[model samples]
Target: MTDSTRPTALVTGSAGFIGMHVCERLLADGYRVVGIDSMSDYYDVALKEARHARLARSNGFTAEVGRIEEPERLMRLFEANTPDLVVHLAAQAGVRYSIENPRSYVEANLQGTFELLEAARAHPPEHMLLASTSSAYGASTEMPYRETMKADTQMSFYAATKKATEAMAHSYAHLYGLPISMFRFFTVYGPWGRPDMALFKFTRAILTGEPIDIYNHGEMSRDFTYIDDLVEGIRRLADAVPERPEGGVVPEGDSLSPVAPFRVVNIGNGAPVPLMEFVRAVEAATGREAEKRYLDMQPGDVPATWADTSLLNALTGYAPTTPVEEGVGRFVDWYRGYYAV
Candidate 1:
């Protein structure tokens, strides 16, 4: 039984990397957290289990194993928990994986999000924050992407599904008066990150004296936001519920919907670091140079991504600005300790 005094939050993908961190933060902040994850085999199930185990240590956190696409299950959870805040983070992530298995994205990102929206509509929360991606700004060569900019040109199926969720959530918000915020994340990485991410892969390859793949021949760049910073940004944004602007007049640089209580905010470091520099940071942390295997840019891959966090700053009075070197060093330390390398 949850304490009636504290507010409850239903977080999907609770066992996932970001989900685990967010659950910890919420529990620390005195919220009762109901976390759900399907434990999909996309990456390391063991890692997901480890994250779940950590969260289970908290009395305020309840872990449930289920897919978000299961509408009946989600509805039951909503009815039982009656969460004041809902955070939707469960999705089939990874760009290359989406290309290999597009159906997974369709099922998890599209169908799963649809189910979540239905549940939220039935049991409306005070605020609902969904995770979008920087990839939604696909093919837009604009540096420092702003949330107000048009984001229709998604280059990957992963990005397309995320963009679709934003639209789906907006419709629900407009029709049902649900307060919603979509966070567009830029290259999130740190300890306990996905095994599929570059930081993990590069660290492992370097430690094992193997060649690490360098796409775009080290020409690419990313606004690598640290996990803690990203979680902190989300924590603040959860309180900054958007309201439909009166007179259809959104503030300059804001992405608030004029017709609904909806907005998209970019959570990023706001500093795009080159791929090689990131590799060098890994080397500095691990004390081992990576054997580089340069390769052509993969399909659905963009050359760079930089976030314009002005709207985030205006809303939360803070922005993610962790330097790559320090962020990468922390990841390397965790990798070494976790893997005993």
Candidate 2:
């Protein structure tokens, strides 16, 4: 532990994409850290292992290879570590994948969170931030998603589970007095990104002379947030956790519960970029034009994802600011160096 004064924090899914970067930030800030991940083979197990390898090199960071849904294991870990703060990032992630495998989402997102909530009831952390997805804003054509907006209609099973997790977290917070923050992340990309993401697939296809699938007939757009920008938002959020309103009169239609210290925040680049523009940035970075495959929109996919991060900035004084062009270029450079393409 670098700073004994800093709280010990536990990050679930620390071997995953955002998890790896979050762990790095937590360690850099001198927090005694413990990371838990099952290292599921949803994408590439080697990629997850590589992330774990990097974190293992840090003295303040520790990891365990296990599943979070296992109640006994989770309980034992909580009992031993007694973490002062918890960042729940582990889950069976992917909107399209959820269409094929709904059970995985139930096991990881629902059951796993249930396990964590139960454990936290006995030993409550000062603050708990859980990962939610922008997909939670399903079926709403509203641009710039706000934290207070209603998102009852979810398009994907994965998103439904995540949205459900937010509800579950709120229940726990209200009943157990847990300070909880649920963050809805927009399209996140950068170094060490998941192989299934469009940016990674597009870059790989462009370099390999293969066709990249342009979904929604290439009309889709997203608030493509860089990993560093998102991580910075999360870091700042760790300290700006919500406290139960003294008067118990919370805002209306808000995810915030009057009885609990819980609220949802959107972490995204407010600027939404078109698909072609993002691809052009990648092309410029690789100096190669991609073979494009215009495909129909797949099930459980949205045409766009725009985040209204005004509430975030108003609360924490910061929102994600990375431009899509620069963020894409950085990812391409990392991909080329990583794969020697």
Candidate 3:
């Protein structure tokens, strides 16, 4: 039953790392949340199930298990929920995985997004937020990537698909006057993160007395945004809906479309930390030194990613700034408790 007093948010990929956190935050804010996740075996299904279990404890949360790419799946969900807000976080993630299975990216990231757009077209939401990636600024060596910059050189198929979705969403926003905000997240880490992600992998290897691979020969850097900080940015951005600029005049450093109620915002810690320092943070948190095996850079990977979050600040009055050490420590605590290590 729909709660007339509270707004409903339909969040796809709700059992995933970021999706789970976003659903919790929305529910905490007194919104009825409808969460959907396919529970694909990209990582540990047990972990994803645990996340869903936590969300299920909340009475305001409703969970649906299914793939978004299925025909009429999203349309049925939209028609049933009539959600006022939509957060499209479901997609085939991982750069190396995309290299191994390009078709998954096509089906989930591209085709899945198409379905979401179609559903939103049929039943318009008050606002829609789509997840993009820092990889979308692929092959662009420009430090502190601004949203207004051209993102034409996607080095990886994963990045290319994400960039394509931005275009797809923009067209929908322009044609249907749908308010859309695309958030380009940096390297996000914290408790309950995906096992494939660096923080979780490193923590597990370190605790189990195994060597951790340091790609790019420990030369790479990343704007490591904490999960809480990233979630806070998304929560604030939900209310800071973009509008089409008047007379095609967008403010300086803004990525707002002049022809549509849409914009791309970078949600990242403005500071890029070295990979070695991040490993050290993990070591500190776990109280164990990692046997670092430095190696050459992997294909379809950038040496570094930095975000220029001034536009995000201007719009939402907030930006992710969590220090790596503190965030890593929090993750380590959760890992030890959860894994009984």
Query: Tens digit of lDDT per residue, candidate 1, span 1-341?
Result: 34889999999999999999999999999999999999999999999999999999998889889888976888899999899998889999999988999999999999999999889988999999999999999999988898988999999999999999999999999999999999999999999999999999999999999999999999999999999999999999999999988898988888999999999999999889999999999999989878999999999999999998888899999978678989999998898888887
Question: What TM-score would you give candidate 1 relative to the actual structure?
Answer: 0.99
* Worst window of 10 by summed lDDT in candidate 2: 250-259
Give the lDDT of residue 33 in candidate 3: 96
For model 2, the stretches where C-alpha displacement exceeds 4 angstroms are 1-6, 251-255
- Candidate 1: segments with Cα more than 4 A from true spot: none
Ten-residue stretch with the least lDDT total in model 3:
1-10
Positional deviation of residue 240's Cα in model 2 after best superposition, in angstroms? 1.0
Q: What is the lDDT of residue 137 in candidate 2?
A: 94
Q: What is the C-alpha lDDT of each candidate?
A: 0.93, 0.90, 0.94
- Over the full model, what C-alpha lDDT does candidate 3 score relative to the true structure? 0.94
Q: Between 1 and 3, whose lDDT is larger?
A: 3
Best by lDDT: 3
Better candidate number, 2 or 3, judged by lDDT = 3
Whichever of 1 and 2 has more lDDT, that candidate is 1
TM-score (all chains, Cα) for each model: 0.99, 0.97, 0.99
The residue pairs that clash in candidate 2, if any, are 144-308, 145-308
